[model samples]
Target: MRGGFARPVISLQHAPDLHSLRALLALLALVALSGCSLFREPPAPEPVEAPIAASEAEPAASEPEAASAPEAASEPAETPGAKPAPKKPRPPLIRRHKPAPPPPVAASAPPAPPPAPLVQTHTLERGTFRTLLDSEVRKPDGKVVGRAVDMVAGPGGKPQEVVVNLQGFMGVGDRKANFPWSAVHINTPAKTPAITLALTPAQLQTPERPKSGAPQPGSPEAGPTRLPMLDANVERANGAKVGRVVDVLLGGSADPLAVVLDVSGTLEKRRTIAADWSALHFVTKNNALEAQLEMSDQQIDASPAYANDLPVRAVSPAAPPATPAAPAAPAAPAVPAHGDQ
Candidate 1:
């Protein structure tokens, strides 16, 4: 009985120690499971609703705000008497405006036309011909006889004869007569000049001038071939009519400087051009005097137009030829030396 009782007691003691170890192991396992819970990942949150576009949403009657006021009100309110959390500053509100459309473009204008060309000019010096119109006629004895009324143009547009209106007392008998141009010497100084006639006033009606009267200005002469100079047709080298002589420009000495040709019909504008007086050659065609110039249509077109107000360069007159000395009176026949005689 005592031996059995001793074995039972040892068993009971071992049993109590084993129960305490099992309790400690169970407590350690509980601590490990709580640590694992701290390390585990959390579940994902639900997605927020997307905002509606301005075009898709219904229009509001009130003034529109840049940020949604309702969204700020939906957040939780701060607690009273508690230290409030620092809030992140909201971004500044910016206004956006739609851009305006561009303006319409304008069409370009056409280019302007080119300018017209200007004309050129020149001058002459010496007096080549005499204009006897309105010049007083004086005799060799310095007696005033008559006044020259008109001139009759000869073959080359030269004055062949001059018509004179003789002065009479109180308009009793004013006779007109024709006299040779060579017979009259021009000594006229200004526009109205007096000339000297080689013949006396009585010789006017002698067979040269008609007993009735000489032809007046613009009248046809009887015997001699009289040609019209002013307003005469101007012909080109090809015998084609280029223009007409509008006027004969004279110098201070009553000499013709140039002939003004009206080339309006051949040019784009109504223009007149000046040609040198020496360059023109007069010819009789169709019983009329015509002037010819050595210029082509292209040459005339390229020339400058003439203007009456244009300034001309004054040319220096040429020196006259020296007069030959008379023969030395035959040297007096060598006046025989007294010693040789």
Candidate 2:
């Protein structure tokens, strides 16, 4: 039995040692649990770290995107205003003006014609003698010899006698001679009334003057020097009537200045006058008692004589001769003298 008891003791001792070992193992396990609890590794630590790094990277990246979005929105707002700037308008165009033209021109005109000639005449009127004539005969060497002293009408009231007086000689004898009215020449240019004659200085000097009642041969008192009944009448080339002879105007050159004559039938009638020098014709058979005029009546009226009469004595002595005198005197009177009963 003892042996059996000892073996049981030994076994009991081994069992106590085994119990201490178990106690140590339990303590170590407790310490390990405490350390694990105090310094514990987080659940999924690498995954958590990865998530934090991703969050930081996402903020950085999102910051750039936010700034870019705002810039893009502002760019769109500016585009609308920029579009209106290009559409702004410009100014209008201008034009210029012009002027008008002028008018046309005109033409010119034409010319005119000429005038006619003049003439003179003589006639008888009242008891006092007078003459009618023109101005042309007053020039030097003119045909009319002297102014008519008296103009007497014939029985039918026609011009009958012309008495002409030759002047300038001292009355050595009778310087007066009588001419029939028919012998007077009317000068248009002379502007005077006068008689033209064929008698030269010799014939003019031979006439005898009679005392008032004494009968000189061929005189009115003794029926001497009776004028022949002349069929020819004193007339103008222009056909006007001539009246009566009055006086002559004489100038320095011995040329007849003018012959003064009276118009017939009326007082205050304009007297006819002529230049004695221009007398062209004297109606006489001998041609010795005749002078012709240069101008016609139309020419006389148109001449300066028509405006005013020229002075016969005012003619210069040195003036050239116009017409020459006849070379010889006539032989005898062509008409026969009537008997002095």
Name the candidate that leads on lDDT: 1
Cα lDDT of model 1 by residue, 1-341, tens digit: 11111111234445558777677567666666766677678986755667757688655769684574456445556567878766667878887788988887777777776643332335533343333445678777777778776555666666667667777788866767667767767663544345677885476433433445744432435323575455667786578876786655444444446676787874367877777766677776667665677666666777766654554322111223469988776455566688886
Off by over 4 Å in 1: 1-122, 125-150, 156-158, 164-176, 191-196, 204-225, 237-239, 246-257, 260-274, 287-289, 296-341
- Residues 117-172 of candidate 2 have per-residue lDDT tens digits of 23333222122222232222221345444444343333223344544444435643
The lowest-lDDT stretch of 10 consecutive residues in candidate 1 is 1-10
Alpha carbon deviation, residue 92, candidate 1 (Å) = 56
Worst 10-residue lDDT window for candidate 2 reads 1-10
TM-score, candidate number 1: 0.38
Q: What is the alpha-carbon RMSD of candidate 1 to the true structure? A: 21.8
